[model samples]
Target: MALLHRAELRPTKLELLAAWLPGRAWFGGEAGADLERVAAYRFDDPAGEVGIETLLVRAGAGPIHQVPLTYRGAPLDGAEPWLVGTCEHSVLGRRWVYDACGDPVYAAALASAILADTGQAEEYFEVDGRREGRAPSMAITVEGAHRADVPQIRSIDRVEDGDPVRIVTESVELAVVRRVGAHTDLPGSRLAGTWANQPTPLPLAYASLR
Candidate 1:
């Protein structure tokens, strides 16, 4: 289960994304344009040490973007380049947010979900001392999914259109699809599917990164 809190965050998520998104090579929108978080999804951290989330944001009237992120209590070693920014969470104190591509926890969790054919994690929120259920943002399906140990991906080699982000690691070529289109699927994709609202079997993620 993934639990949420109704607390404040310094330099809110949208604020950080506003300043960070335009600078990315994959982002085609202007940094100054208004961006809205239209949808989001989460994955469970079995150890309960990290927070994994994927956001669907729209800038102005342009295309939607998929940004997977990981939140930690401290800096991620060797992943300084992926840091989105730091924020102070009222409930969790200070947190270091990074693009999920470089965070091992996120990478593993995502791979596990895809290969296991698991959907997005169920969500709940803390209300007073009670846990209340909430609707999930989207549903995912991974075709040809098979059980396996979560793959380890250290970092991203590069980002490109029509290809999964390759891992920089040497042993395995694990790749994940980026810049998804909600209406279509990718060829050569090990895992293929879509969000709940998408009208077709959109290519949400891929299994390997290499």
Candidate 2:
């Protein structure tokens, strides 16, 4: 259970993302594009085996996007069904699975970090991906521990101009500002699988839940 610190890790999350973003349908590719990591922060897990990172990537010619990703020490067996895909780590000599939205441990930690306001020693908001004139004027705070039940956690908070939105994750609860105006809910069957196997839905579908 060796946990790799961000400082000690190479090919930083943005580097991995530069190579990985083009592969996703959500990315709007620009010719001869480059990706710069505008901001990044880590989420701590009690176990510390899995690495959780929240990153804001600025594409050379496209809008900045927040990409949350998880890195595991080893392949998660029986998780092939939930994985977005596997990429060969040139340095680690192992294939790392990319499934930021599905991993349970990562989800739980994200939810907890977003909700806790007792002044943690670690900084989770260091990664600022906001563009000029588009930055959120105010901070978004996680309301409270609504529920950590499986498949959904009902949490709400105000963002920007006091707009409230609920963040529901499998096995853990999180509350955040709904900047995208919508969120997609994963199917029930997909929600039942382990974090590594959970299915991801479009962000728009999440707004429908409200």
Candidate 3:
């Protein structure tokens, strides 16, 4: 289960993405265009240290882009290049945010979800000293068979950022689609989702054992 805090963020997630998305090679819209949040989903961290969330945002009339992010209390070592930026969480204090594709914890979770058929995490938010169930923003389907185990990912070996961000670990190779519905033919165990105006599921990411 993923706990949600009803706290304010200094630079909101959309604000951070607005400033950061245009620089990516896969971003197809203008920097000044308004970005509207389409949907989002979360993946649980078994150790419960990092926050993993993937957001779908549409810029103006352009395509919806998929951005998987990891929120950490401290900076992820050797991930300076993938850092989206920092934000002050009213409840969690300063947070170091990075692209999820560069996070080993995210890689492990994503690979396990794809290879083992584990779906998105359950969500709950705190309100008035009580825990309340929060509905998921999107629904994900995994196109892979159940597996006994997935290899542990201790570090990210390589990251090739493009239309699809390729994260290579010792035991798995993950391809995270930067633009939803753009790269559907990536050969691997797949993860697809649908939400709101998008009824048909679209490819979000895929993984293959290395």
Candidate 4:
């Protein structure tokens, strides 16, 4: 479950992504003058220490871009290069954010979700310790799932320019589809999802490189 914060974030997510998106390998040309966040989803960290979120954004009227992100209290060890930027939270103070592709916590959660056939995390708002359910912007589904008992993630990398990040461990070669395709018709895809504003589900990623 994700605990929603009532406080505000300095330099909101969209602002940071706007500055960072152009340098990415998978970035298509600008669609318009303003970037808008179209859809969003989340994955839960069992430990409740890491914040995992997936954002689908459109630059004007361009193709929606999928960007997964991870938030941490401190710098992730050996992940200085993947840092997206730091921001001050109205409540949580300082947070170190990074591309989810490079985060072990994110890799583990994403891999487990695809392999086990899971969807987005349940969200809640904590008010003085009371939990209230929150709605998600997108829906998810797993196509063909195979269970992995404790699928260990050894390392992760970006093989090509952008999108389709590769996750490596001792078990499977999981490709996390950033920047989702028009349709999730990819063979061997373990998971797929539909944006709340979109009519059809699109392929998010596949796992089968053992």
Q: For candidate 4, write residues 30-120 as lDDT tens digits.
A: 7445788888889989889999998888786567788889999999988877789999999899999898877878877887787776668
Compute the lDDT of residue 14 as modeled in candidate 3: 94
- Shift in Å, residue 172, candidate 3: 0.5
Worst 10 residues of 4 by lDDT: 154-163
The number of the candidate with the highest lDDT is 3
* Top candidate by TM-score: 3
Query: Of the pair 1 and 2, which is ahead by lDDT?
Result: 1
Model 3 compared with the native: what TM-score? 0.97
**Clash count in backbone of candidate 1:** 6
Error of 4 at 197 (Å): 3.1
* After superposition, candidate 3 runs with Cα above 4 Å error: none
The global Cα lDDT (0 to 1) of model 1 is 0.72
Each prediction's RMSD over C-alphas, in Å, is 3.1, 12.1, 1.1, 2.1
Candidate 4, residue 103: Cα displacement in angstroms equals 0.8
Write the candidate numbers in order of decreasing lDDT: 3, 4, 1, 2
Instruction: Please report, as a residue range, the 10-residue window in candidate 2 with the lowest summed lDDT.
Output: 188-197
Assess the local accuracy of residue 139 in candidate 2 as a C-alpha lDDT between 0 and 100. Answer: 28
> Number of backbone collisions per candidate, in order?
6, 9, 0, 1
